[model samples]
Target: MPAVNSQPRRARSGNRRDEAARVAVLHAADDLLVEHGFGALTVEAIARRAGVAKQTIYRWWPSKVEILLDTLIEDTAKRLPVPTELPTASGIRAYLRDFADFLAADPAGKCLLTLLAEAQHDPGTAASFHERYLEPRRIAEIEMLTRATEAGEVSPVLGPEATMDALLGPIVYCALTGVAVPRDLVDTLAENILRPRA
Candidate 1:
């Protein structure tokens, strides 16, 4: 039998430690952002809350915004289910309606709203949010819209980018402004955007 390498064992231990610390930092960031808002979130604060050194966070993320972005991704992944099996129109309406309900129910909503407001002034932060968070959701929407367009459920003239903007932009605006769009409104919005042309 071949002897086991000690280095590989040590590397595995290190990987586990790294994974644990990373999860701690992300959860700590989520809690801090939810409890105190973005203004109070900092690498130092996250490190303190996670009980990891600040250098550990900097080694992984470039900025506080990056950490917040990760938390947003985590939060959304756990809560949002963008189903591909349903008809595209139904999927989008159901997903956005569930999203609105999540916003009404989860503190992550407040954290996301605050992060977005901050992004308006910070180009780097905004770019990170766009790439890490918004782009994936946008990609999913585009795919859904493509399916809808192929099925003739949506107007052939209605482009994915424009249709999504027309459909979802108002919901985002309402979220930012503390107005809530109910599921029926979400259905109406999706119907309007996906309505077939003559």
Candidate 2:
């Protein structure tokens, strides 16, 4: 007969405490980045803000950049959900809406912009970001675009990469240049990307 519980039981209380501390540290890091920007973020500050020891943070993440990147990943995963089954223009619209909402509502948006800037000027940071965070999501998005193109949801001529660039460029541009994206830009982007070319 098979055992009712196949896995070994662990110390639930210890694990919960660890998770709570970890979450506090991540949230504190995110809040600091948003409130003070990247330059002002530090492990000591995160510890104080999170009400944890500095060593606790360093135990999990080696550096401040790693903590910030991890926070960004966690925030994106929570906020900007991409549909995994089928990629439709409508699904893209939904994803875009969620992304826009995150930018408007969450501090992670500031962290994202800061990482993008670091990627531009700092190679080590860029390497870590691409290897750990950006590239995997990028590949997934491109695959999503491929499915969208195949389903006649977007223009095949531009293919996945170009279409993705077009759709993403405006959001980044508006963010970086201080121009506001229209309230309906989510719908506008979905329509423009999916509409037939002349």
Candidate 3:
């Protein structure tokens, strides 16, 4: 007789129940963060709101910060997707507008601010936030700029890093400072940074 395998089965990636629990946990974390702020956000609270065991939350995410990071990534991807079909300048403008709106909107905007604040004190959080969240978006924006340069739609005078800073800095500053992002900021940024080939 063959020896019985005594190890417990690991959850499959495509398991429906696992996916549902994941989504529930993410949603619960976002809702709780918005409702009670990060100070009150805990693994226990997330588990309760998600209707899952505390151990389940721990099984997937080690801590509340990880859960919030996941929530932020999902929300940013959904709300501020990069424009693919438009011309580079137009795409940048559209993206900037979306970004501004995202910073102003509830839940996601709040989530971003919360993470940024949390990152200030904890080196581990800061590193993970940069590596996991900010770097991907930065790379995507740089690719957009590269395409525009290759197409001769815009001058390549500004380096990719400078261009991103110019386009994103003001709106993010406004968001952090609690000031309203100007209505014409996107247009101004696009026109200036993505100046037409002359």
**Reference-based TM-score of each model:** 0.82, 0.83, 0.86
Model 1 lDDT tens row, 48-112: 99999987888788888887777778888888755676355556667778777766667667667
Top of the candidates by lDDT: 3
Better of 2 and 3 by lDDT: 3
* TM-score rank order: 3, 2, 1
**Stretches of candidate 2 exceeding 4 Å from the true structure:** 1-17, 184-188, 196-198
lDDT tens per residue, model 3, 109-156: 889988999999999889999999989888888888888778887774
lDDT of each: 0.76, 0.79, 0.84
Weakest 10 consecutive residues, lDDT, candidate 3? 82-91
Q: Give the Cα RMSD of candidate 1.
A: 3.9
Q: Enumerate residue pairs that collide in model 3.
A: none
- List of clashing residue pairs for candidate 1: none
